[model samples]
Target chain A: LAKTTQPISMDSYEGQEVNITCSHNNIATNDYITWYQQFPSQGPRFIIQGYKTKVTNEVASLFIPADRKSSTLSLPRVSLSDTAVYYCLLNAGNNRKLIWGLGTSLAVNP
Target chain B: EAGVAQSPRYKIIEKRQSVAFWCNPISGHATLYWYQQILGQGPKLLIQFQNNGVVDDSQLPKDRFSAERLKGVDSTLKIQPAKLEDSAVYLCASSPGTSGSPDTQYFGPGTRLTVL
Candidate 1:
């Protein structure tokens, strides 16, 4: 199983860009990094996913280094609605199970 | 297309009592999953089902937890004699393809179980 480590929490102000990084030193070659955001009393919602390099979507951008040992989720011009817990997950093509660690709780203040 | 649907948004029961949760996956989804999310912790996969067959239940406590997906559509997870440690949010998710495929999973609102 691949394990991920990220910050316990983060604080940001509205209109600022927030970046959360996760480290997975033992990640497999076929594993893909995925991010999810969860608000209070709700299930997690998928944000962005990437295999290598960078992948951008309307919601967020995912940047992966060449070693694939670490990945960063960047939220541009974040607002108070972006306040939530963000999770980093490794999805393996061969395995169906997903191992989730304690996510980084982001607080976007006005 | 509707996302995954779980009934009884909240449930409260005493220790040693029985409880059951129902889940209806999205139309045409072939893979279904059940997860347990404890307070201040991430979601933990409890079981996974491929169509109507059980694919994985390794993390599920078989002595007290049992889940079934009948006719490849709806699923039911039952716990006989619940424990205090079982108090958590039960989440249901579904995907269009199997685990080998790179498909995003759709999640439901989840059922919050409170075991007293």
Candidate 2:
């Protein structure tokens, strides 16, 4: 099983870029770093995933260092609607446990 | 394409009672997952299914919780003798089951279970 650690909360204003970092000191070799976003009363939605280096999507970007011990999710020009809890996940190989720690609760203000 | 679907949207039951949640994954998807999300916490993977077979259920509380996916299209998660701590949002997710790598999991709206 792999574990992730993130900040409890973050605050950002609209139109600003936000970066949420997660630490996984014991991450495995075949693990992939993934990020999810969740609003109140709804399920999480996948934001970005990357094995190493950087992976960018329409909504967000995932940056993983070569050591694979940590990853960062960046949201460019965030808006009030981006207010949600952000999760960092370590997908550790097959038949492995998926760990979803208490993620960073991001509050995007107007 | 439609995403994962779960029902009923909300459920309320007293402790010691039993309640069940149903989920329908996206059409043609071969992987389904069930997760439990308590308020103010991230979603925990309760079970994972590949087609009609279970890939993992290590985190599920087997003493009171049970889940099954027959025919591989839909799944049901039942909690017999529910407890107050069982109150949370039950989420269902699905993936394309791409070989060599598991694709992204698309989540549903989730079913909120409130045990009083």
Candidate lDDT scores, in order, read 0.92, 0.90
What's the lDDT of the predicted structure labeled candidate 2?
A: 0.90
Query: How would you encode candidate 2's per-residue C-alpha lDDT over A7-93 as one tens digit per residue?
Result: 999999999999999999998888888888999988888888889999998999888888989999999999999999998888743
Query: How many Å off is the CA of A2 in candidate 2?
Result: 2.3
What is the alpha-carbon lDDT for the whole of candidate 1? 0.92
Q: Where in model 2 is the C-alpha error above 4 Å?
A: A93-95
Assess each model's interface with DockQ, reporting 2 decimals per model: 0.63, 0.60
Q: Pick the candidate with the highest TM-score.
A: 1
DockQ of candidate 1?
Answer: 0.63
User: Model 2: how far is B112 from its true place, Å?
Assistant: 0.8
- RMSD (Å) per prediction: 1.1, 1.3
TM-score of chain B of each: 0.96, 0.97
